[model samples]
Target: MHLFADMLARVHAAAAAVLGPSADLTRIVVEPPRDPSHGDMATNAAMVLAKDAGQKPRDLAEAIAAKLLADAKVEKVDIAGPGFINLTLKGEVWPDALRTVLEQGKGYGRGTVGAGKKVNVEYVSANPTGPLHVGHGRGAVFGDALASLLVAAGYSVTREYYINDAGAQVDVLARSAFLRYREALGEDIGEIPEGLYPGDYLKECGAELAADYGDRLKAMPEAEWLPIVRLRATDMMMAEIRNDLARLRIVPEVFFSERSLIEGELPDPFSKEPPKPLVDVVAETIAALREAGHVYEGRLPPPKSGNLEDWEDREQTLFRSTEFGDDVDRPLLKSDGSYTYFATDIAYHKSKFDRGFADMIDVWGADHGGYVKRMQAAVKAVSGGKGQLDIKLVQLVRLLRNGEPVKMSKRAGDYITLREVVDEVGKDAVRFDMLYRKNDAVLDFDLAKVIEQSKDNPVFYVQYGHARGKSIFRTAAEQGVLPADPAALQRADLVRLTDSGELSIIRKLALYPRMLEAAALAHEPHRIAFYLYELASEFHAQWTRGGKESPHLRFIIQDDPQTTQARLALVQGIVTVLASGLDLLGVEAPEEMR
Candidate 1:
């Protein structure tokens, strides 16, 4: 149960009672006291609502304090600062929270903060030109973990990938595969010419074309062969990408192709009719914006910092993004009358809105930070302010081995692929290390250190903590201190866990639901990773403390079976929370670590 959320609701109700039901309670927040000496929770209800209510902050606090004094759960209410209400709950409340964790087990930290809202999270939309790289892995791991986090918080989330198959890059991929195809047909294709994909991955596509069509494709003209080859190469590359994503366990619900947005008859491949707009999505988006008065013909200013070598000033189709909080108006088309990347993206996001996603999140590389404002403004213009677009930018990744930088890859010849990293270190290490830091921050993923089974290794430490909890349960069973069945062990007298260390761990366990709620609201899965590390550290600290001079704090006591069972229950609580959190992170919580 969300104890703090419950208390905040009570505090809001008390404020409403004191200052009429019409009082605005939105600004008030009840949070854990920074300095634990103050109280369990402190609220800023009076301070936030005081000026609007036309009363002194302290006086308003006193009035609300009087109303809260009658609550059965509140042992004391201390007023501090201008109007902060510090509340200390009954001591037994902590023990009751421990019981709640025991009873909930796997469901201990499940939260309902999302209220079953539908959210679409699109990530790892890497160009289907090649295998996913380590940078893409960060986004894949992050998006998967974020989706799982939202599910834990009661949101129905759709994980998606926007396939960029219609771009010029895929045409390049087609040309590259054609070279390999010629090699397959005994043409002895020499050195891969510049400006075409040189990766060996497309050789399979070349071989497949040779095996399926034999010389049929080679006999066709460039235009006819190019279409069939581009489609085949893109499909094969996308399949390879899906296989790599499976290594990381990221299965996107939808692979929305960018080429599918243009919904009209294609100009005949044989007919030379100047390619009738092909049901341009970009044109449709511009028309919609024009109808809304957000689109206009305008010229954009030149670059701010770069040399204006090729800068051209001409009136063109533009979206008035400045009206929606963007810094400037954005171009919707290039000089060639084709849709720019921004225009197609606008159509893509609008399609998401069309599919019933009121809330949409796009995980992008840090280089795309400048692209955020325009996209958000476009969503506002398209959805008429009914849709929300949240873009998270993941920064660069630095791959290292031990303390030395590790670079280059045999597969891609330029950089390490995502599958290579996953093969070098297990998926758990790759995913956990990627998320152990914030998305916006640059990450240093050390291969050697990540695999080390030390406390310094956050993933191993947390997994080891789960294994240690299992060890305690096994020890308890062998000593006949508790039953092997978890349901029976949960029947222990938890009131016996009065020690400060035991209560501290129990309090940490109680914070899981609140942590998950906050993480989901903030759209940050790193919070879960960081929380798991701290939880493991606290558990290990208590265990080491017990080994030192605190024998009474030991989880297993030979003479006192009841106390042992109670401590074993706490161990089970730790294991349940760790496993649940690890499961959310797509990390394995091993019963025993080797």
Candidate 2:
């Protein structure tokens, strides 16, 4: 029962009837009045549709007001300056909305904005080189929460992780692992090379190689043993990555390998044959773009950065991305006649479109901001303007402890690992703190501040709100004032809840469904975090007012059980909404704080 949605529908219907059924009512919206003293809700329908109605804004507002005043829920309709319509719903409407919240429980705020559209969300595509760092944690938490939010809004989403296995970095990883292999065989390897990875986590991979084939890999040539070592090291590293992600409760449905796009084969899922010929997707993608006149051999001007020393003036295969709104045309091949990174990226996204997904989202680090336009252009050219690609760039995190920068991990050798952060403080604190700010802004994560059991910490404050609600039920049942069963509590008389503070809590709870839909459409999970904090703050304030302002406003009254039961019903609504909103952000709602 979304109150604003219902009222907006009625306004649209009335506007259509008065404007001859052909009016553009999409712009008409029902929202809370900017100033609470004005009214409960306000609409701009009259102002937006007055031109088509061929009447003054106030005249149309009066006619629409007349139609709305007849509604049972709307108690009063007032016309303000220049065609603004303000609606004040009946007092009973608030109680009925609370009853709906109790009836739905955890399913209270679920919406239907997505309508079952298939969306592919690819995130945390960190290379299988080593352990994940704090920067990777931000993107992982953002993408995972965004996927949960879309599902709550009725979108069929697939969580994916793109494995960057085929690149020069993995070669460097292989060389680094080989040194550890020599050390594992009881050889004197004093120091790691300057260009290779120095993380001590690779020692386990080298030890495994030694245990499986003792002195066997030492005799083989570098070319022969490189592939064998690369496979084993990559498998071991990916296993470690999975374990790390599991600690944070993040499990991606698909782990698509980047190497598969170029070297491996993809079978046509729609083919009649069991196993068709191995298709070279990258080559086929380039040929298709060539046929469509989007690909050609041309020389790009020197880069705008003025670093022309490394620039080559010779003609190379290029993609005409400037025609599709990119800054300039992009190259598809390097000087050595090999496919560029952008070329393979285009083919990978085309594969997502081929698999029946028209909406795709990629979550990348802040450093990848310059790559968004080119990728979007490629999606437009490859999908024939039918597919949509949205790229979200997550900024880096500054790890701190008591206002001091935390030192880097010895195991990772350069930066702090995500595993270490989760191990120190539980998953809930890490996740909520990461999403407490916008994805595009710089976040300062303080280890000491997040674990404080005080109002300054948002995670603790919100979880305490849930615990406080449960505490009221426990205290009430102890005094034999009311039953703890939700079914029995739902039958409580809600009309007794007439306090302005109590109604304020109900109004906040009623806005959850609308906030969730807007956040999902905008691809921002921080909105959910912010909404939960505000609701918790309001509930806490109302609880304090009960003790300081009036005794009759208290939740549990020993002499009268009816008012106590009614207040408990309000608590039920508060806890239900708080739990649902916390779950969407991948945070836990605890039953008790201590």
Candidate 3:
């Protein structure tokens, strides 16, 4: 159904026949020309094939153009600047493309780009200590959209969230909840002590504790009270995190707990038999790695930025990450006999690989950029070079209001939560605007601009296109010109859609499948956002032109029901594609936003 791909296949065959079937065709790329006047599509095959064919580039271009002109799809072929061959397809081919779009509908952009490979996407693995902030929201949205994109490209995807419940952060959470519990018992707890969370969200945990146990836990020792409070608070915080994710339309297929990795015999709460702990499983994997010479005792230098005042130079259990291209070896254990964060991460990734995931993608914050090389090296070590790990670092978002930066104090309570952003501008605006730029580049999310109901706002522009398309259907219904059924619209005389404005929209619609494949293969969901904006721009421009020049060319026609149905079919195609793209980004395709 992709005209571009079909045209490229014909060119590939012709080029192979001319080059005597031995030429390498890997570098051949057929894409839409930057300038529409160049042609419907352009290819640099002649230039790429010239050196191998031992001929001047233009000579090869003319030769290839002669072969392409013989194909029925190529109505005209022009040799442009620097041996670029531009092919203008026949007009009839475009209506067929629209027919394909209507026939496929939601499945229009589906492609087998990934070839059914198993990919594991680990994202939003926030610590079970508190609510997710705006930073975590970016990663969550990026990762979830990436997963959906891969699925659209025919890859089996596992959406996963890693719970950091086995770390010092959870311990801190335990202490903080214990303080709140004391306060709930009417104890006048002074200013929150150091090394404990001070967020007001913890008051509910204290209240729940007070309701469950009147004074039974008041006299308990720290050892007994700490575990109970930690478990209870972690559970509550994770539930809150899940709800927050739901608000943003992100749901993970798997929630891997870090605490499950420790070695112990514990009864399964739902079953009678005791299950083996994950710590033993990780230890066994480490032993296998050690047998393969990837683990050893080593000392690591202190990190460059953070203050490590308690730093003691000593050899510790380390992963041989340096052998696999890491800058330095990483320690698995700290001096106090506790596992470092890297250790648990390594175990978690190893578990993913053991589950038969050879392709893994990790979405982390920009601050974790330094850890990418080591994590990749660990994956190579544990998987014995059979697995690949791709780490995507999402840069920090600078929130702005009315052109001024919003200052957030992590130590104080003056920070914005993900829920706040979602509530203020709405989930659709937040998701689309967050993903409208490249993930590696810092994004300036201006609150005022996103919420503005104007064409200058891209979120509104694209959604307005969808709404306008639906509005055409409403207008047709009001004029007694609505299509009797979807099939009637599908079978509308699309040949009537031959005007420049109508054909341009069809051309944009035709690019969706190929665009999806490219965006998915590149692991860039932002490309979809950018494409939606451009498509909406095309649709809106055409609508505005029709308003001034030819009102009959507009979507609805009261005088001619057949033309109205055909035009409505075109509008339906636009709406289908916009909705599909927005769905991949987890954004809403709003019918009305005013």
Residues 129-235 of candidate 1: C-alpha lDDT, one tens digit per residue: 88899999999999999999999999999999999987688889989999888888889888899999888888888999898778887778987888778888988
Screening candidate 2 with a backbone cut-off below 3 angstroms (N, C-alpha, C), the clashing residue pairs are none
Candidate 3 displacement at residue 189 in angstroms: 0.6
Best by TM-score: 1
TM-score of 1: 0.95
Cα miss at 346, model 3 (Å)? 1.3
Q: Weakest 10 consecutive residues, lDDT, candidate 3?
A: 262-271
RMSD of each: 2.9, 3.6, 3.1
Q: Poorest 10 consecutive residues of model 2 by lDDT?
A: 264-273
> Across residues 137-202, which tens digit of lDDT does each residue of candidate 2 receive?
889999999999999999999999988877678878888899899999999998887999999999
- TM-score, one value per model: 0.95, 0.94, 0.92
Clashing pairs in 3: 261-278, 261-279, 262-279
Number of the candidate with higher lDDT, 1 or 3: 1
List where candidate 1 sits over 4 angstroms from the true fold.
263-279, 306-310
